[model samples]
Target: MYSLLGVRKKQIAKMLFYENMTMGLIALVLGIAIGSLFSTLSTELLLNLMGIPMDIHFEIPMNAVINTSIVFSVIILYTSLQGFRLIYRFKLIELFRAEKQGEKAPKNSPILAILGLSMVILGYYFAYNFIDYVEKINFLMLALLILISTVGGTYILFHFFTVFLLRHMRNNKNSFYNGMNVISTSQLLYRIKGNATSLATISTLAAVTICSIGISVSLYSNIEDMTKGVYPYSYTHTVIDANKEAQVDATLEKHKSKHQISHDYLLKTLEVKGTAHENTIKINKTELNENTTITVISQSTFKDFAKEFNYNNVKLNKEETVALTSELSIKIKKQFGDLQESNNTKVTMSDGQNLYTYKIKEEFPYPTKNLFSDTFIVSDEQYEHLKTTSKEEITRIINVENESDSKSLTADLKTIIDNKEMPLYDYYTPYQQGIEGSGMMIFVGAFLGLVFLLAMDQSFILNNYPRQTKINLITQSYIKSELQIKK
Candidate 1:
């Protein structure tokens, strides 16, 4: 083989098997082509089958499918290359031959293994990106054929590839059998044994790569929803003080007039019924620390508040009320313990003259973000009546109607709050704070991604590399005729 190439036997074998330069170059190009095909077919096929809607002339699922495919392709390429670097420490030639061929390495299996790994990775890229379209993909049998061929191709490429390369390596010299062909055949047998680990490594890495990337993209996208749309865009400011809504509206109105920011929708709710109470200070109402309980939100105002989030718009009569979410109720129950069950130590704040109280009702899901400190919900009339009867703090919210005018309106509202002497409430500037808050989510995502990438990469290097080397050493035995048979 070397005489024809004018190269030594070892060098020719090494180049053919370890380098597999011709095959590898072709396989890489083929991988790229396959990825493109997956992308194009996934998108265009969907469009052809399901006509686009006239009113909306934008890319829908079609775009997501194609873009996701392309993205995953890039990720797969990157991860495969990384894996290759990790696997090379074992030397590619030995891995394939000792593994799959089950003989000494032709010094060829390493490159052949790389080709195999790359093809399998390409298969995965296609599979992951086209998962939704897999059902629609008519080439299921063809792809299966290709995958099987690729696996067969892996073994054949290492074992007997020299058959095709004989002319290149031997110059059509039939005179030079000299056990060289035998060596190559033996190389093939050994490679069959080691195929599992190499393919498994590639397969495992591909799966991890897909999982991590999906998690990263989905989570980051959700962070945008959480910080941007849900908070600032939906409800700019949340108030704890009930008396401040009117004052905030006045401020917003001033900002609108001054800064051309013209939209502040004001809403307010005060306590009407102090029904639910955690027994504070051993039931001593006269003592200042009588109750460190959550202030009861009135049921009447709760009626109006429910309307904001598209609640049933149900009218609250005398009997029914919103209860705490079951989860929260359980925690509250645990806190009260025996006092909660006995009912003797329990307190209901109701005076016949004004205040009318009832038994405690739980607030399910709290109707608020979990991150906040204190939370309660009730009706406007209930809140107003409570204000008249008790000395508890009120909660207010000045909703901004014009999402576009958020900044100027926030400025206007702040001015109004200052002018009216209403102390600061929880202020949420949709644009300003929303953009800045996104950093934390981004930071967390980056940190987690880095950690995962490092951990998986370490596993590849620490674990796979040695296995690769051992397999190659065994292949070396086959190639160098070091494997002695003692019958």
Candidate 2:
């Protein structure tokens, strides 16, 4: 319209530049204000989730503001240049006809459709067997392969597969001739082609949102069980001497009102060099026979603790053994099936003088008093025989009521007992830490989900806006034609 008014192309370009700059300036200001507000709110929420107590004041960094302004300024300048090029590239008549031009319908091919389906199926296969890939291939390469296949397949499927399917369905004369079927199917085919990339992007975003939120929720829910698996007992520590044990008991009695002891037991262990036949017992693919410290526990104590912890029950005769491994070893074994599944294998341990052999009965994932070594359970008679040759170490395992809420009691006990004499393991610290960590993940996951959802909505709106404008223009044209005919 400005050009048709005898306005010079340069002047028209200048006008467009000014108009765009003004709008850009307004948007930049509003965006900065809104972003600053949200940043403060989100930061406070994250800190709170992590159990951090602090005041959050709304403050925008100068560097962030300057960087944002520079970026948007470049964007506005680029858009202004585009407007200038548009004015010089076409005449006034072409500019007027541009709005009426329709998008060319994309070609639909059966080959492309089949290819897209194949790619999507291949991606799904890789994703399902992700663990296998993690072992066989580089992690980044596997991730890249999945990303390209899934994202590209999605776009291709939306672009060609839907069109092919719809076009094929239209071949049936009965359905094709039905009222509004042709119009609906034809419109969908074209609209999908036009928005295929955006649709694919939205699908990807939705998947990420679901995965993040699902994992966060799962982690938060399982934190308690995970903590118990790691800690096992509410309180555990090595018994340095009888005098220190007496002091611990006295401290517990002093804090009886605050925390009541639920269960207390002593574990006596003897560390010895152990080896399994045919490399039957392994940690990290390394044979346990090579200078590994195997902590020996008696069968009677193992049975008592197993029953208390609701673990697998095992009854062993003389010379029978059960191996106890940590949580990480259990996970590794689950991924790569247990190397030593046979019950016929045997483990031999020496106490620097006498060597005793025991048949392998079962293996269980359990936390032992010895943190960094494998635990071996033997018959009481066998254990006594080995203990005579080696020094016996004792650990006190104490379970208290309201274990998670025993923060004060733990502190008081720590103060009463010198850690140099006996190391104290309290459940409150790890449990509290787990809550904080899980809470932070949940917050982060929820935040990301919201961001993805908003992006999807914006993409949908932007894609639909032009089609809506065309419809409105057609409607207006029809009304004007009707008025002219009535006249």
Candidate 3:
């Protein structure tokens, strides 16, 4: 029984010692992190006080973290190092002992204490540099969060570092209220005293309840995902005639030279020839300018295209027509076959009430591999056949950036455009045709935020102060029974 008690004491002592060291380190880091956060915030506060207009774009919450850390570590080390000086100055027996028997402050207070506080406040002011997201650092919410978290942290810290440590010091009479009770119990009570107060109880509840964060995140994600499919990767004003292709190419070159574009390119148009299973099916082309279909095409560049998406580089059946992605086949009302499907079609027209028959190879979605059109997959031979519809020009695409610095390049290209004097038809710069990428990013961020907020829903709920009733039981019999179990 004594050994078991000894083991418990040792275990508690070890835990207390371990936590003491950890809390010291967290204290150091927290001082730095919170300080940096406040420091940036201080600048903004000062700005507001001075009536200065400030627009915040970027803030890196790293500065206060570093400064506070150094200060905390130094303070800890200084306390330890100076104790060595007292080691020799104190009594002969005190020099040899492992610990002081009483509850004594490790060092002289006032100056060091004030200095530590000052360092902390100053460092914190500097650390919280700038957070437009958290405008008004002195706001009630920030104060409440810090205050409540500090209380909660202090309670847990007391439980781990003070109460646990006091188990070993139970025999120390001067510390344990003349041996009647434990100092750890008193310390624990002191740490959590504020948490029990009427006003602080609300904050305490908010600090512990965690679920409001998840809902906000989910809401944002759903809203974003709903609208993210509108913007395709990139598009340029394209003309299809072979003669107009040169004209459009010349006009594009002028813009390219003006814009200092290094890699201007074009997409190949494949001639796709095939009919639907039913000769009655006349595949009418959707209006290019208005069609909202997401085209998934398999082209001669099928390998390169599929590689880009991390999907299989579909192989054609050497002789059979190439097939579409499963997604596209479903959209186009076609046979749901594998990547290679050989189907037969008869392109027959009623000629003045007489039957006119034309055999057509079966065609699927992979022929027109454009971004916002129907998904089309076509082999090289199939593409050649499909090009008959695109008899005019291949699609010209440009990868370039138009910036303020490249005036000479812009002017040189303008002169070339004047020389060609080609009719300035519809044209779009790369800047005008970028994808709906930011929308997707925003949606994802909102989704994660909603999830986090919902996860913290309880916290938000707890912010609404609850009226809690207190019950005091004064039954001596029941109280004594509980106290006996405690003893």
Candidate 4:
């Protein structure tokens, strides 16, 4: 269509639009049918592997289909009009001479080559070194810097350095004088100089696409493992009242007796406050907001948790305490070089009268649920003092025997909880957390990956079109001249 637009402008526009739209409609129909079929098959296969039973119903969303068709049709019409406008802008003589006049060879620069190499190395250094501090800095800005430097470096290397080296090779008498070598080298150098930016763009796109897909796949594949690290328990419930705690326990035991279920449950009583004051241990100094949560659990409870999870057990005295924080907190501490074998920090409670100093014996990955931000394990005497001084909350963490039984047990427990109106909180199971966290990440990553891959494909075709056409014309002209000489 673009090729013929110069000769029969209006006729070509009309014919091409009609033919393209017709083909597009046919493709849309077939695409929807095949896509729907495959989607249903894939869903069934996934469900079967997950041991889920469901009715298979083949359904296509009409809204999506209509929206897609409309979008494609508009794109096709706009592109066709743009092509016509481009053709009309060119004079007949210029169109004929376009193949005859090639782009001038570009000059090579050693400075640009050196600068490009330095930028690439510096970009990689920042990417590797500052990745852990992403939360502290502007992540988007850092990412853009990396991308621009790497891509600009690639272009400079291809355009200037590569040409410089190849020209030196061409200057060699023995290699240059070899049959066909001179012609091939000159042509290759010219092509590289002209198409350097396009090649660099394509290379960058391919790298980005592969990296995005690889990270997304890795996140998806390791979702269960990651979830296990963050959420060791299948269900975590907070009980405010002692009566409710006993009732919930009895209910769980009754259900366990009815069904073959293995359970390891922990009940801990602790005093929690939303804000920590100036004298707090200050475990997370990087946090901009001064508001830190204080949770004081008994030393015995801490020991029980450590024993259950196979963590190193530590004893706390009335004068000293231990702290347990989230994975992110540990990372932040490590980044600041604050993470040692042990660290002692002073903590002040909400009550001005009671000031206690504590040593952080160890840090463990804990749930980031709103209930508790940071936990301090104190001796029984300190716990009793805190309990009498401040309002104490009871928390229960339960671990199921098998991951497979978690969903069913969670459902049963939720049903039981919903029947009564009690001030209780329940944390999501690992499977649910995986779906909500990793599942959304994979979806967004895959979508962006697909868009980038498609863009790269279109760019490669568009950028190479003129060069391919020029090469074809030259080959055809050479063949025609040989035939004429023979005749």
The TM-score values for the models, in the order shown, are 0.36, 0.78, 0.29, 0.74
The most accurate candidate by TM-score is 2
Error of 4 at 72 (Å): 1.7
| Candidate 3 regions with alpha-carbon error over 4 angstroms | 1-233, 240-263, 267-319, 323-369, 374-393, 400-481, 484-487
In the order shown, the candidates' Cα RMSDs to the true structure are 17.9, 5.0, 21.9, 6.1
lDDT of 1 by residue, 278-361 (tens): 435232243223344334455544555556544444333453344433233445445444224323223344422543333333
Question: How would you order the candidates by lDDT, starting with the best?
Answer: 2, 4, 1, 3
In terms of lDDT, the poorest run of 10 residues in model 4 is: 283-292
Could you tell me the lDDT of residue 16 within candidate 2?
88
Tell me which residue pairs clash in candidate 2: none
Model 4: lDDT equals 0.64
Off by over 4 Å in 4: 1-33, 41-56, 82-94, 132-141, 172-181, 241-266, 272-293, 304-310, 316-318, 326-328, 335-344, 350-352, 364-373, 415-433, 440-487
Worst 10 residues of 2 by lDDT: 281-290
Clashes of 4: 0
lDDT of 2 by residue, 222-337 (tens): 87777766676778788777776787898789878867888787777887667766435432323333366578888788888777667776777776787787675666666765
Task: Between candidates 1 and 3, name the one with more favorable lDDT.
Answer: 1
